[model samples]
Target: MTVPSSGLRSPEARRFLNDRLDWNLLRTFLVIGQEGSLSRAAARLHLSQPAISQALKRLEEQLQVSLVIRRGPRISLSSAGQEVLQIAAELYGTVSRLGPALEEPAETVTGRVHLLSISRIQSRCYDDFLARFHQDYPQVELEVDVLRSSDVISALLQKTASFGLSLCRTPQPRLEQRLVLQQRYAFFCGRRHRLFGRKHLNLADLQSENFVSFTSDQLGGNLSPLTVFRDQQGFTGRIVASSASLDEILRLVDCGFGIGCLPEHIVAADVQAGKMWRLPPGDGVSDVNVYLLWNREQKHTQAEALFLERFEHMLLTTELGERF
Candidate 1:
């Protein structure tokens, strides 16, 4: 049934009329508009190309408007389609918010929250926050996947993850981000290394040293902390080993293969036990910002809100806060 464009005055009446529109059609329309191609939209929606085309046709018929202009394999929104797109986005956002806005009391909240986070965060702070959140809301399931920073953003964009924690900044306008923590990355060496116990060392002193480096892929071709430090210090060193695994990097450093750059928190225990030594000042090391990101289109459920609150509190009261 088509919702007539006239005589809907009350908010509830508008909502009722909106309910008459096929949400599947609207979703398909939005995806096609965003992707600008039926095949891409079909891939994203996991539907056949012809099915996506049919849904768009049906949506235009229901709305009584020519929503798109098709030329060969390309698609572009008509003026009317642009207006409809705006309205559809607003409607979709409103519908998403409805669940949390009308949710029951906090104690009764239940459902799973899927979270994607960088592996560094998983290693450093995941356990403390997960344990605390579980203690408060035992019935709410929390599913977490540790991925690279780029993968975290990808999962958020795909809507496969409700929330993301990333070590890199999210440049996408569609994602909302908040600064979660600041982590200091410093150079470290095994106790057996020549410069391990040095009180002070110039940047040039380490120019010819071999280094165990973190993989550059996680940063999406952007500079890593080590690269940034190298540029700033004009060091001409070669990476003797590189890996995506932080454990492997640490092990390589501990075995006296080369100096490794890592977050201070990850190596605090090793430093305290004299297994490794942090390089002194003048190394051009700096703190990197970590961000918590989520799609603005996603509504917060009561359980998700509670989890965020608890997680924020934990971060504020712990060593993460101190580092920040």
Candidate 2:
């Protein structure tokens, strides 16, 4: 057999480094880390004490370090074991996120977990956040597909999506609706538009305004719920165009094509600089929640649960509800 050298460290003595590391053993370590006892780890692994001990021994032998410290019946990890546990967690996590959106691997080398979400929500600055998630668990592959919220749900029901992210609309019992994120839409116009710095503009003021929207094919969608007053009052704006593409929508808004609606996360910078304004109070302007939905099966994955935890935590820290 032949070996190539990077020379940062000598090749490990184990001729079968890849073959020697059993996924089952690393998984056992993680369970022990959580359960904190050999008996519990044994029960969870459905193996006898000897089997679990041998697996642990094989892992330690492969790594050339003792991972667990003996202190009575309760075991704690040594420093080297702590490092292994941390790296194992990260490696296992990475393997679970593989795909175009998740492309970082090199952690555990796990396969793929696919996801679907609405374009509006998908555009809200998650690339940086997801990249950070990739740093710790690079093996997981992730595929993010953009569809209308209605299409997303349909896809989930048809088993086309492992998960879904979208706006919180009128709730239904068929799927689980988790209020994972909050989204607020702001009224916007081009810097060169006639209403650039207007104050106290009422909802009625927008009746004659040109309106650009998402294509009406999307469910619970097309026009934003925020723009309902215009359609309900027997008035329709110039209605020059509609699009599913966010980039095009932003371009149209920037070029003074029409009054535009944008989620709070997407337009915070423009609003801060005084380019967009909220419709004056008492005009029935309101906000909505950014929700996450998945099949009941999706709830079974540890990776998905961790993602929801981190996602909810970030939103809480940002105090998104108070911002609205």
Candidate topping lDDT: 1
TM-score for each predicted model, relative to the true structure = 0.59, 0.55
Q: After superposition, how far is residue 134 of candidate 1 from its true place, in Å?
A: 1.3
Show the colliding residue pairs in model 1: none
For residues 125-154, write the lDDT of model 2, one tens digit per residue. 355557766775576678889877667778
Query: lDDT of all the models against the reference?
Result: 0.72, 0.63
Question: Each candidate: RMSD to true structure?
Answer: 13.1, 15.3
Q: Over the full model, what C-alpha lDDT does candidate 2 score relative to the true structure?
A: 0.63
Model 1, backbone clash pairs (residues 3+ apart or across chains), number:
0
Which candidate wins on TM-score? 1
Q: Candidate 1 on 208-294: residue-level lDDT in tens? A: 788888776223342365576676677677888877667888888988888877888778889999999887553427777677788
List the lowest-lDDT window of 10 residues for candidate 2: 1-10
